[model samples]
Target: MVGSLDWTAAGGAGDLLAPPVAAAVGAVADARAAEIDPGLADTAAFCEHYGVPMEASANCVVVAAKRGGETTYAACMVLATDRADVNGVVRKHLGARKVSFAPMDDATSRTGMEYGGITPVGLPAGWPILVDEAVAAAPEVVIGSGLRRSKLLVPGKALAALPGAQVIALAQR
Candidate 1:
């Protein structure tokens, strides 16, 4: 019976990771899987569910700003220990008077990604992806997998390679 067991079938049955996320992670060298059942509505909930040591995980958020009557997107990657200083750094970087976290519905709709699953990798081209330097320093960091139920463990170098990601010191103490 053990020899006859289908590992793929068994693994697929309870997979919390989405296919796209899995594929993206798989494409990167030195990336590993860290599946979690995070019934995450937001970063805090995600951290809580997975018991991710704050020192090792990153919180990825999408901020929206209206610049010259045009809506712009900013992908902020901050360490779990600190919050993205959206109004301070993000607004200044985007050159917008008004900047805020995009509504969940808007984020999901625009990115075509689920809440708690959005990552800088494989996002639409031309979006500004700002990664906190702290996150980049970690040997391995956990990030959302483009789906809520699972997270992906990727090396910092792999994340920096994602399109348009600028490693910046933007996290608030």
Candidate 2:
């Protein structure tokens, strides 16, 4: 019911998701999935072509927070209309001296997800998932499926309740 795309139970779309995402879809009881043109995976193209409102889509960004000589990777979820406050709220919350978007290779390889389709779900254990308060307050939100060819739909509360997830004021707008 998100866009013009046909949605089906997430469990039946394993082929459209990365292994980790496919395995974790069961955690969200109302999770649904829809296939889309892989070439349109980027947020702007996907939303425009599929008729999904920008506000209804959430983007998951991978970040690297460094302190001393150690680096910690975390995922940040924010609505498409907002930007994650990586250098401000996120850095302080992560207790890192510096915070930036993770390198593309590191983000994709570590999470076992595609660069453009990373999602908070199925992330490696122990990694913090910072979800913007606006994202968690949405009635329903669309997010990545860990595969460029598909997207996942879930209730906002389920995302906030994911293991290691912490809802906070993480969006700049």
Candidate 3:
């Protein structure tokens, strides 16, 4: 029964979304969500089963990079058709020695969302959100609503305007 929720009234499911994400979506004029099975949550399967276009779906990845013996984190969003240039662009942008996907546990716990459903909307305020230019150029895209059982439909501009979010050419191909 998660059909078309305004982020403000998302109910118990709101706990799965980061506090800022929950509030921010409500303020985004075009944000909305629809229910789906948690089992079909990952991008490919969800897209195939629900008939969502791969080009219009964005995947949010949590990355951790090491710089001067410290681990810094960022949430990167790229179109499902492209890959995040983590080792090259991300590491350089973060000024870190190396970068990799965040450990599953760290990502899930830190974002307060399921492993496959972490999104950029409400990531920790300090964790930068890098949205690939391709994704930011789309009119609208489907992203995780912070729960495995739902998906959020939002305008690309809304994502680009998220706190600490930057629109960059973040894709590898």
Candidate 4:
């Protein structure tokens, strides 16, 4: 069980999310394992090195949107095979006139996750974590672990349980 296992077993950076987020995910049954790899700067390179099939991987991206002059963050989960329709679904979902991918600096700074290794698990609690319905339908999904070299293989359901996660049809075919 997650409680019995030393979560600190991998002694590097701690969970990216606050205690409650990790606790909620840890409470789920059969949550997949997290593996740390060497730091990767891009998705294709990370997938090749880790032998992770691109089809089975879900890419998590942080998009910034302005609603009523207030900036907000939305965590969009898209399949590696598909891209998040930021201008379409994301803009409509957030009711923003304009939205754009957050700058690299902003993403890294806020997430505590390196460029290519951002995962939904430990994201800041308030951000809306949207999962592409396709990802939720998969048997197993590979995702970032808040570290460039690390990844977590979790069941779709477990991913849905993360705090503030919403399953939506937000991926482009």
Best by lDDT: 2
Which 10-residue window of candidate 4 scores lowest in summed lDDT?
1-10
- Model 2 lDDT tens row, 70-90: 999999999999999999999
Per-model TM-score, in order, reads 0.81, 0.99, 0.89, 0.81
lDDT of 4 by residue, 1-173 (tens): 22111223222324533332344446544555444446553667756765667787789999999887889888999888999999999999988988999999999888867777777877777889888898888777777666664555667777777778889999998
Q: Model 1, range 16-129, lDDT digits (tens) per residue? A: 455555544455556554445556636566556556676677878999999878998879998878999998988988899899999999887777678878877656678898
After aligning candidate 3 to the native by TM-score, how far in Å is the CA of 5 from where it should be? 13
Q: Pick the candidate with the highest TM-score.
A: 2
- Cα lDDT for residue 1, model 1? 10
> Stretches of candidate 1 above 4 Å error?
1-23, 40-51
Candidate 2 collision pairs: none
Tell me which residue pairs clash in candidate 3: none
Full-model lDDT for every candidate: 0.71, 0.95, 0.81, 0.72
Model 3 segments beyond 4 Å from truth? Answer: 1-20
lDDT of 3 by residue, 65-119 (tens): 9988899899999998899999988988888898999999999888877888888
Candidate 1 RMSD computed on C-alpha atoms after optimal superposition onto the true structure: 5.9
